[model samples]
Each structure stands twice: as structure tokens, then as C-alpha cells.
Target: MTTQSAGEPGEQGGPLGMQIDHVPSEPGGSGTPGPPGPWQPNLVSTPAQKKAAAQAIEDHIEPDTSKAGDHADDETGKAVTAFAPKDGDGWVTSTSLKSAHKTWGDQVKNLMNRLASEKAALRSTGLLFQTTDFGIGTGLRQTSPLDGY
Candidate 1:
């Protein structure tokens, strides 16, 4: 188990602020064997860090999507419909505009949903790591000769 210090809480380290302990040598191949010693955590997130990250996503990213989506809708829906009413001149262009508007709206909605899920995942990350570390530490402690004291 390699023991390298992790980044300070809430400080982004690597790209995406993530680490992977092992990876397969090739597709369908086994990953690096488990360490002979206790597990070492290379990435860590505190409760405050998780909360702030999730909150930032909610406050900044989620709200901006509406503004952006509305801009696209107005440009595509209102402008196109004005120039080419659906049943009149430039009807083909109007139909195309409607399709584009719907596609843009759907994409925006999908992005918002993905961001929400990511925020939820971020909020729970600290707790998940704490629980996992505690369980592993407890198991390792039980195997120690020091426990006989």
C-alpha cells in the first residue's frame, strides 16, 4: 500500500481531482494485485468539501442552464416563428426551427439531470469514504497482535 499525502480538503489536485488505485493491463485483463499491507487512500474529501462542491453545482451550474436554455428557445422559437409561421410562407423553415428548438431543450434538460446526479454523488462522497475507511480499519485492527493487549 503506497502512502502518499492527498490534497488539502476542498483543494482540487489532479484533473477531475480523482485517483485510481489499480487498472487492468489490457482489456479483459486483471488489475494490479491487492496490496499486501492495509489500503492507502490517495484521494480524500471532507464533509465540508463535499457540501461546498455540491452546493456550488446547484448554485452556479444548475441555475445557468435555465438562462442558456431560455436564450436558445427565444432565438429559435420566437424569431423563427415570426419570420415563418408554421402554416404560411417559409413553413418548411418554421418546421425546422421547431425541431431545433425541441432538440436544444431536450439536450439542456438532459445536461441538467446529469448535473443534479453529479451533485448528489458529490454530496455523498465524504460519508461513503468515511464508512469504507472505518470498516477497513476495523477489520485490519482486529488482525493486529496489539489487540491482544
Candidate 2:
């Protein structure tokens, strides 16, 4: 006959042949409690809910073309003016203001590129949410706007 302790290895099907030393008590236990388990929400999203969520993400991914174009044009003008030769008769004209203007123009260009990259990343994420299977069995199918792209 084989005998095992109540909390011993494989006694109650504990993980990895290890015993559970302590069970979690209610709040306000003297000993420090273990980390919480993974969260499992009881609620499931309906088709309408899924559609609304996908639409919201899609809307958020849309870039403001007009504003982006205006900013790009303004920044290009500033860069051209900053690097242009001065009216004075000097071989090289390097002023603090010109340097600052050049720096500002470069910063503007960096900001625009960063914003575009971030938008592209967000759009890709949104598309993933639309196409990837959630495995929730809600019978909801999301279609990405960039499906053909």
C-alpha cells in the first residue's frame, strides 16, 4: 500500500510534484500573501461591442493629412531660410540665430517623422486587433480597413 501526506507531492495533484505550503487567506492576513493570479473577466463582448471597439481604434489610427501637410511645408520653409546664404559679403556667415533656426528646423523634422512612425505603428496594431482571432467564440469578425494594403 502507498501512503502520501495531505499536502505532500502529488497528494492533491499539486504542480510539478511540489506541495502547496499555504493557501491564501482572506484579506488582512499576518503573513504576506502570494501574488494574485491572472485576471479572468466573467463578461464577454457582444458583436456590437466588438464592432464599436474596432471602429474606435480605426478612427484613432486615421492621420490628419491637412495638418501634417501644413506643418511639413512650414518646417521646409524655415529650414531653407536658415541654411540660405546671408546678404553680407562674407565667405561664411555663422550666427547664433541661424544655428538656432537650423536646430529648430531639424527638431521639427524629427518630430514630424516620429509622429508619422507612431501613427503607422498604431495603425498596424489596430489592424492586428481587427484581423487576429480573439478565440473568445463571440462569433464576431473584425475587418481591417487596410486589408488590401
Candidate 3:
């Protein structure tokens, strides 16, 4: 339930820009483990529909290849990992971009609402939810043929 403050919406005082770790638990390990109790955020039940919806949502994330796709770079001999800021050792966002907090919240909420709707659609498929799988393998990158990665 941690969220940005109603007022000031963007700053260190508020929790707006903070990235919360969302660990999607298994679909149904509770009780008898036969049927899914409910459609949890991270838990994609056995039916491929639920998993497919989750996959689509994940693919929409426009990953910063320099920060993400590092695995690919390692094999290709490219250093994609960001180096620590010479100014300090720990994480620190540029002060000029402080207002980004509010924007980030808006983006996350919009994506979440879309994902929720997709999950609901899967639930209506009339199949028992047996297992959950949060698959984020199929990544989508908008790369131009001119800009070789």
C-alpha cells in the first residue's frame, strides 16, 4: 500500500518514484492446492490464457537496453552495465529530474489497470486455475535496422 504522498507528489519526502519489489507468488499452493483461490497480481494460473496476458503486459515495458539486455551484451562482448556514479557509490537520481517521480507513478498505474483488465478476461475463460506462472521471456524492443545493437 505504499504510495506517493497526495501532496507534493514528486520528491524524496514522498514514496512516489520508489520502485516496489513485486514478487509474484505461485498460483495456488494454499490449502489443498487444487484450484486457484483468486487471480493474484503476480500469480498466473495453469491456464495459458492467464499466462499469455501476463506475458503481453511484460512485453510492453520499454526496457532500457543499456540497463537490461546486459546478458546478451556479455556474450557479444559489449559492456551494457551502468557504472557507479563517480560522485558516489550508492544509487542517486539526478536532482534536475526529481519531478520524474510523479510521472513514473502515473505510468505504472496505467499499466497496472491494463494488466488487471487482461487478467479478468482470462478468469472468465471458465477453466480451473491450477498453477501460476509469471512468464516475462518474450521481450519486445523497438530497434531500428540502422542502429545496430
lDDT of candidate 3 over 1-149, digit per residue (tens): 45664565565565364457654465545434354455645443566766676556556532332233344335323221233245566234433233343454456566667666766666655443222222222233445697875
Ranking by TM-score: 1, 2, 3
- Segments of candidate 2 deviating more than 4 angstroms: 1-94, 129-149
Per-prediction TM-score to the true structure, in the order listed: 0.56, 0.30, 0.24
Model 2, 88-132: lDDT tens per residue? 533233344456556766776676676566555644664566666
Q: Which number leads on lDDT?
A: 1
Ten residues in sequence with the least summed lDDT for candidate 1: 8-17
Between candidates 2 and 3, the one scoring higher on lDDT is 2
Ten residues in a row with the worst lDDT in model 3? Answer: 129-138
lDDT of 1: 0.76
Best by TM-score: 1
Superposed on all Cα atoms, the candidates' RMSDs to the truth, in angstroms, are 18.5, 16.2, 25.6
